[model samples]
Target: MRVWISGGGGFVGSNIVRAAVDGGHDVLTTAHTFVPPPDAAYAVSKVDMTNGADVRASIDSFDPDLVVHCAIMNDWDRMYADRQASWNAYVNATRHTAQAAIEGVDASYVLVSTDWVFDGTQGGADELTPPNPINLYGTLKLASEMVALEAGGAVARVSGVNGQHLARPSTPRAQDRGFGYFVASIVDSLSANEPFTVWEADDINMVATPSLALECGEIMLAIGEKHGTGVFHCCGADAVTRRDLAELTCDVFDLDADLLDFGPPDPASMLAAPVPYDTSLTTPRTDRILGRTATPVRTLIERFREQYAAQVGEPS
Candidate 1:
């Protein structure tokens, strides 16, 4: 199958590009600013997703059998700092991409969404649960979801995705830029003998089902291959809190747990957006559809450790 992926230079999209090439599919990908290293297995192009004409032209030129829209403005700090840019990246980009996919080529479309679409009053939300986003990021993501679905496309809602930086692997600490960068940041701090703090929402810690970017990418490909529609929960099976995730990272990387400190969530921190306290998701429908269970947290962390070690030229 000929597959085209948006945001190919991003954490999750880069993994999807590798997975598509590994799966023997003809792949075309787009990046806005950060151009990925050239690879013989697939093609990469610079396309402004927020521009309708650019998006349409790229899709029409590729004429892909499937188009997976993974581009999103998910930086919590940036979302609050500039709402208009976030809207353009999320809502506008999604609208243009979905239109190009459906109207230009009639290609099967799968949108990469997030579990933040749900309110934190409850966790383990399934596909049937109605979304009630609490922050601007989630609201915009929900809007993007609606756009894709209204255009007769599928939505793959993933959570806490992390992996090695495929686009700029040579850059020092490049893994600290995208979703799930906290894990790498923690490792970096502890390795440097510096103290690290994990924040909590009052007495309760924020929880999420973290998944590896590569695994999420494979699941997305499965959705596109099956021509899936509606929502699919593509996340880790284990719902862990912020502290638990930190402890797990320390364990996997054999770092010092004594350096870890606890604190309340601070708005002055890089995470300025109002995050849901517990946005963990369950993947029963995704499991049934893909014929596989979501990965466990420890297992995912172990894989991340290996990838990080390889990126840093350390023994895993």
Candidate 2:
């Protein structure tokens, strides 16, 4: 089967490419400008996701049996400060992907969503849980989920994504930081002997790259081949608090506990009320239907350490 994946250069997209190829599927992927593996099985193309013409042309040209909408304007912290750009990236990109898929050979679309879509209020949320996104980024993702679902696509309301992040650094600007740029920040803080803190009380879900992509790849193939589409989740069984995650990492690396910090989440940070104190997903339906489950947080973090050790050329 021919599969078209947007955001092919991203952590999730690249891993999906490998999974799809391993599954004997001909995969075609795209990057923002030029960001893909040098010798990737999937033919990589640069796409302006916000531009409908470009997105449409790419989909039409690929003529895929399935479409994976993994690319979105996900500027994590910046979205809270600048929502207009977020709208263009998330909402506009969704519009383009939907319109393009509608014109395809009845492509099965799978959109990647986030746990942030929930207003951090619900506990043990199910697939039917209506999204109460707290931030503009999550709000747009919810909107995009509706867009993809309306196009008769399956929406994967994913949780936190974690893995060794890789990208060709722009230039010889500064020292080479570690993988998982976000986690790297923590490592850097530890190296500087500075304090790094996170909300201790908030629950968070984390998924590794290979695990998340493998689940998505399998689901896309099944949905496309079987003509089954709906909402599914990609998250681990055991969820960890933000504070616990930092502490776990510190323990794994045998770093100083003083280098990490934790506290209650700022209630005012999100727009949704009754914030989902435990945004964990009961993925029984997902596991039963898809025959897949995401990796545990420990394994996910372990992989990161392996990759980190490799890049640093030293043992963790």
Candidate 3:
């Protein structure tokens, strides 16, 4: 199958590119400022998704069987700080990409959304749950979802997505620094025998069913291949706290847990937007659609360990 993925230089999008190539699909991807390393398996084109003409031209040229839109302003703080840019990236980009996919090639479109669309008060929210986003990020994603759905496309809502940095393994982009990157940072600090401080707060301690980017990529591919439309929750089976995830990373990487200093988040550094306390999603429908259970957190961490080991040329 021919697949076109946007934001190929991003954290989840880069993994999607790798997943598509590994699945033996012809892949064409778009990158903005951060161009990923050139690989013989697939092609990468520098295209700005926020620009309708540029997005349309790229999709028209690729004429793919599937189009997965993953480009967006993913940072919560940044989204709150720069609302217009986020709007352009999320809503405008989705509009342009979905229209191009539908009109240009009639390709199967899948918009990569977030579990943040749900308010944190309700855990295990399903596809049937009416979304009431509390922050700008969620609001924008919800709007983007509407655009994709209106275009008769699928929405794959993933939560707390993290994995190895495929774009620049050595040094990830600022937007790419997520839970997985935090784990890597812990590993680096522990390897140097330096103390690493972890901020613990009511807002930041929200529970989430973390999803591995690689697995999410595969799920997105399956949704596109099946031409499934509607919302699908693609995330881990186990919902956990940030502290639990941090300890698990220490366990999986064989790092000293004592060096992790738990502290309160600095008031100055706290996010401006309201954060959901627990936005974990239920995936029974998604599981049925993919014919597989969502992976647990431990297993996801173990896979991350393998990727980290391979990247660092160390024995796992």
Q: What is the lDDT of residue 3 in candidate 3?
A: 98
A best-first ranking of the candidates according to their TM-score comes to 3, 1, 2
Q: List the residue pairs that clash in candidate 3.
A: none
Write the number of the candidate with greater TM-score, choosing between 1 and 2: 1
* Model 3 per-residue lDDT tens digits across residues 51-121: 89999988999899999999877677677778888999899999999999987899999999988888788
Taking the tens digit of each residue's C-alpha lDDT, what string does model 2 give over 1-316?
A: 8888887667666556656888899888878865565765678767888888889888998888888888866455667677777787887787787768765556777887767677666655777887787656667888888887887777876655444444343322111111123354555567667777554443332222222334445555665666556777776666665555666667765568786766544454433322344566656667677766656766666666776677553332
Of 2 and 3, the candidate ranking higher by TM-score: 3
- Can you list the residue pairs that collide in candidate 2? 120-275, 120-276, 121-275, 121-276, 122-276
For residues 1-316, write the lDDT of model 1, one tens digit per residue. 8999998887778888888998999999997887655544788778988788898988999999899999877567787889898999998898898888877898889999988788777688999799998778789999999999999999999887777767666534422212366687788788889888777654232777888888888898998888888899888889988788889998989998999998764444534445576788898888898888888899998988888777774422
Clash numbers, per candidate: 0, 5, 0
lDDT of 2 at 219: 57
Indicate whether candidate 1 or candidate 3 has the larger lDDT.
3
Return the top candidate by TM-score.
3
